[model samples]
Target: MGKYDLLAKDIIKKVGGKDNILSLVHCVTRLRFQLKDESLADDEALKQTEGIITVMRSSGQYQVVIGNHVPQVFADVCRIANISSEKEGGQKKMSFREKSLDLISGIMMPAIGILCACGMLKGLNSILSYLGLYSNEDGIYILLNAIGDSIFYFFPVVIGYNTAKKIEMNPFLGLIIGAALCYPTINGVDVPLFGHVINATYTSTLLPVILIVAIAKPLEKFFNRVIPDMVKTFITPMLVLLISVPLGYVVIGPLANMLSNGISQAVLSVYKISPIAAGFLVGGFWQVMIVFGVHIVLVVLCITNIISGTPDPILAFTTFVTFTTTGMVLAMWLKTKDKSLKQIALPAWISGFFGVTEPAIYGILLPRMKHFVISCLCGAVAGAATAALGLKYHTMAGMGLFEIPALLDPAQPGVSLVRAVIAAGISLVIGFVVSFITFKDEEPSQTKGEEIVSEKCKKEVIASPLSGKVKPLSQINDSAFSNETLGKGIAVTPSEGKVTAPFNGTVMMLFPTKHAIGFMSDQGCEVIIHIGMDTVRLDGKYFEAHVKEGDKVKKGDLLITFDIDAIEKEGYSLDTPVIVTNTNDYMDIIAMMESGSTVHCGDDLITIL
Candidate 1:
């Protein structure tokens, strides 16, 4: 295989060896994978792997950030994994909330590669200045700082481009809106909207541009519909440009700023009440805010305070969150047996230490959500301790480990420095110990086809609830069961009216309608025995519940008896689907009997391993 081809092979292996993948697609800087089970993919491993740029789980996609060569990598992934380039069964429609998340990630993620590079550059510059290797006045420092600040300064323009694509609006129009927001003449301009004076500062902001583009989509649509076909293209864009820029500044920009200001006041209030509690909250949820792209304004606020010689203590707490993230990754590195996970965890840990936590946050912690919570609690503890010890930053500085040096106060006589170190140690130890004790490697990916379950993995045998002929779930008439949206299992055309316990389980629920019975198998399976499709409409007619919910039942014991003839005559197909509701919990569930095979009560129906 070629270099890119080999890289794709490695990518597939790290993402649970291709079998776990449901579909794949690509955007500007990402290989978005829709996986069968997200937990099976080793995101951290993929992040540390060559040819991959950090990982992100947003909008129900396991996004592997690949750079400008993403299309080539995508082709390689498709070829290597033997999957189609186009996503199968078009991605499920997203909810408004999900669409919002998709918009934010799509916009923000495209810029993340440069953002990481810039952050690292800035951090490196900070390191050099602290070490006396470079001064802020040096040409090298000035040039490097400018390069590092490029994306942040022009962030609004980039966000506009992304928003346009998301909402299917004209791209350049979105770019113009963003450029107008960032224009030095327009930046920080004050305007009145809805009888209120508002500061329209759009530079390096997210909400204003996003809201502007969102409004522009419909406006573009309106112009496209009304404008004559002859000069429609130019006329629509001209009219949109004319209206959107002014509307953005007057309405969207100011409104976004007001909301941002309200949030800033709330954050400040929390700190004003109790610095310790504020520190704890900041340390714990700071990364979360960064994830949602909500930290830009707060960062601006803190930087403004620092520039005006006002101390901003709250942000200093966030530095410890990085340490805690580092600690958790270190624990994963030490504890995990998976060589791939161990490899990525170590690098992720190091990255987190340097205040570059995207590696740890996206690649590791977020996948294992519980470990993320542990990391947050550890950070909270460290933050509270840091505040109690009176550690605060008097100067604006780089993030992560670089912020430690800036936390020292000349007035505190070196004690603050010691406390900074102490707080870091506390966060590290807590994160490490807690994560190490609780951390477990992901359940190993199963072998191809029939799952080769481990010895300890007990198999659950579900007997046929009612005997007749077996049918593939997809062949069933009802979309809910046939589509497997409810769960995976086989449907049976019952020859008899009675339903029996498929396994040694309790009647978890006996629906009032008596159409379906939910069972909790002693083997920990949640099986639902629906007697007939849409038989619930019968409203207990021609259906009799033999056992009430919570009643224990042995195998072959009757649970429900329905008049099958009456139900069929009533236009309901008695295609009883014995569904394993918690299908995700097991490795693989397979039918013991072949489709169309005749079966009786106590016949082996499904086997879950």
Candidate 2:
């Protein structure tokens, strides 16, 4: 068993066993579940469970809030629960916007790290060549450049494997799908399609592969459903390959070409109307175009412009976007309280300086969307500045930050290079300041949990479940409780061995061990009144539950009574936690009394806002 296997099994059981989970996917932190019934989930048990941060129910998803390591836990959950598309009745349905973003994220995220590394190398190589340390003709330079160039040139094949995994199709077929699209030049074939010619090359293009997979997913699903089991393995592959390949060439291939041409012409038309306006639009919407796989048309246009001896204004305008993303990532790094997000932000922004913003875009900016908007706004301003100042790319240059040298004449650098520098600087600053100030995280991104205050909500109080010395969660012995990973609220050292309903609520769970009780208020607050640390190991010794799961209880009603002295003598600390497991639902969870204050049963222990 893996390290997470035990946690995974326990989670599955607490979530009402394997049968309760309809499907599972993870995003950043939470293990998102489509449960057969949310009520069946032991929400308190999960909150009290080690490693889970908290639980959240939002938009029909029963989200088990694991912190940064959710992906690992998600894997283990899927494996142990025997969850898959077929078992879960297929993956959860998503809206068009959700599907599109998820698809882009899945395909691009896997390659981002390597792309960053290669881009940095390529940037360094450009620096070397510009400085006359090594020329492109050098054998060593050739090999290094080849390594750096391979992923971008053959990105479609890389995308193919990832897309298949995302859509639950065979990865090798995805590979073949990518390879077949790229290897055969459609322009060379002259294939006819409704009086339109399939006269385009798919090399280094993302459109054809993405379109092919989008089409192949349904076709493959259809074939799997209809094909006989006897010859399914051999026959399905044959049919999918035969059908998808031709469709990629005749139909999807033509569609990509048409889209590319239409986009390029539209951009050109805008550019002709006013270069400054075009620059602003490109700066703002270029990333959006990149998301849809149409930005390559502008890339092609830039190269064509350079070949024909006009400075590529399009490329110059687009350059500001890199710095904008980089600056926003820096803001994300500085502003986020999440250790994992901070860690992600560091490497991503560093890569941006070298001219690879893929990591930053996919990792930090795209997920939050506010960061993306800030970056785009910055980019639009810089793009407009570039055009307004007549700063265009003097020649075809290397990728990323290293291209700074290419825009300048080594012997006589002019105002053009200075203007370019100024534009980029303005974009970066705007991106950083705006993103840092405006963005809010999924959690409270600033301040440690110390004060128990907020006025955004009306006052609602949780009476002391046990009368004792009130303590902050930080003073608790258990890391899960101390860290507030299980959710927020204060702890209590019980002088009396009794737990009562803190509010009028149902007993959501009475752990079979009889040590911990989970309650949900009629007002919708979920609380866990854990009796003692590691007391569950005592096998219900010195513990008695007056209430069973699903019983409705009034405030001050006795729930569970434990022999606190016996549990303490047995080496378990009776630092019981009365946690608001759904702490995020409120503005603040306030501790009513200071730590070390003596409290009686039914005192206002917690003030929820």
Give me the candidate number with maximum lDDT: 1
Expressed as tens digits, the lDDT of each residue in 80-197 for candidate 2 is 8887522344444455664555455556545544654565565456556666887779997898778866776666688787788777787777888888877755535776766876
- Cα lDDT tens digits, model 1, 42-61, are 55466668767577666667
Off by over 4 Å in 2: 1-90, 184-198, 226-230, 264-383, 386-420, 424-579, 582-609
Q: Runs in model 1 with CA error above 4 Å?
A: 1-103, 126-138, 188-200, 225-233, 284-315, 322-377, 385-426, 429-461, 464-520, 524-609
> Model-by-model lDDT, in order?
0.73, 0.72
Query: What TM-score against the true fold does each predicted structure earn?
Result: 0.59, 0.50
Candidate 1 has what TM-score?
0.59
Q: State, as a TM-score between 0 and 1, how close model 2 is to the true structure.
A: 0.50
